[model samples]
Target: MSISDAKVDVVKDLKSEDAKWVKIQKVFYKDPNGKARDWEFASRQTRVEGSELDGVGILAILEKPTGPEVLLQRQFRPPVNGVVIEFPAGLLDKNETAEQCAERELLEETGYIGKAFSSSPIAFCDPGFCNTNLKLVQVSIDLNDPRNVNPKQQLEDGEFIENFTVPLKEFPEKLEALVSAGYILDARVQNIAAGIIVARKYSL
Candidate 1:
């Protein structure tokens, strides 16, 4: 079945006992003004031991004769009750580096093996609601690589992702169109697209 056929079967509040990947947490701290404050948010339970990061977002750039294209994906996200446009990403496993996670996730989700050149500082998602954090990993894919020819995805069961690319020059417009078409844009994707648009407009 396609993404359109993948609808949410049910919706309910998850019990703490049933939480396998996350947990509710409350933190009490003293504010700068000597006021005591408390905050409650959902925290991940899958972070590697001794590591603060929960995952890595892959920024896959494909080099083509015409120009560079950014590899992107569309997948069903049950939380939002819609399909989301997202960059390839996944949580880190034990003893896994962010770079290795980027390469593995990219290949599994998009069938593209890429070179992780760099990664950004940790960034959080919806700090008020959750403590989810991910590093943005920069990956480059060479179209000329023979192994890349007829690349095959290695997605796990129940994962349905559609991989495609748009020219980096037109990413902003393309992302806008996808939103208009009723696709939820992940915050990371939206911010990256906005960054490119702003940088090019100001010739940064």
Candidate 2:
């Protein structure tokens, strides 16, 4: 799990007045099996004008005939080349709390207004390259209400999704299949799913 000879050599010093997704020069140093390998990478860095806010959202939903029901969305992400089942997530608007973002995304994506049981700070999705971070929110649903099963409204211009429910015990299998199919390439999501599995197993 350790990357050897990991070094960043700045090629160009970027300015803050640049537009989003500004390119900065970077040289990557890699020592593979004691051999020196140098690769130049054009790193992108941008100045986010707005204040940084925690992006909190729900994940690892579950549902059953009698037990607690959870919500999940099958997201059609073009970047990944297909649909991957995942929980509803969104960035917190400026001045908004992580809990508020979690509730908003849950309702907007899956049309469910459930309560967040536990939430995590906005952790780095990938520290090596991207500055994107996500706040992990754990939510418990109220299945007694019929509105929880309603169709969700897709807000993103081209967001195509399918909402579905499954028992908590079956989440790992679905996640595994998504990984096998190359839809879930983000390691952060995998790590979140592992934590979810531990949570559900202990709850039951």
- Cα deviation at 65, candidate 1, in Å, is 0.5
Could you give candidate 2's per-residue lDDT for residues 1-204 as a string of tens digits?
A: 211122344446556346365344455565757766655433334222374543654763544466654566666554445555666777667666777778777777767767777877657765555556677888766666687666467467745556766555565676687668755434545665687888887994
Pairs of colliding residues, candidate 1: none
Give the Cα-based TM-score of candidate 2 against the true structure.
0.65
Clashes per candidate (backbone, < 3 Å) = 0, 2
Candidate 1 lDDT score at position 55: 96
158 Cα displacement, candidate 1 (Å):
1.2
- State the local distance difference test value for candidate 1: 0.91
lDDT of 1 by residue, 55-174 (tens): 999999999999999999999998888899999999998889999999999888888889999999999988889989999999999989987888888989988989899999899999
C-alpha TM-scores of all predictions: 0.96, 0.65
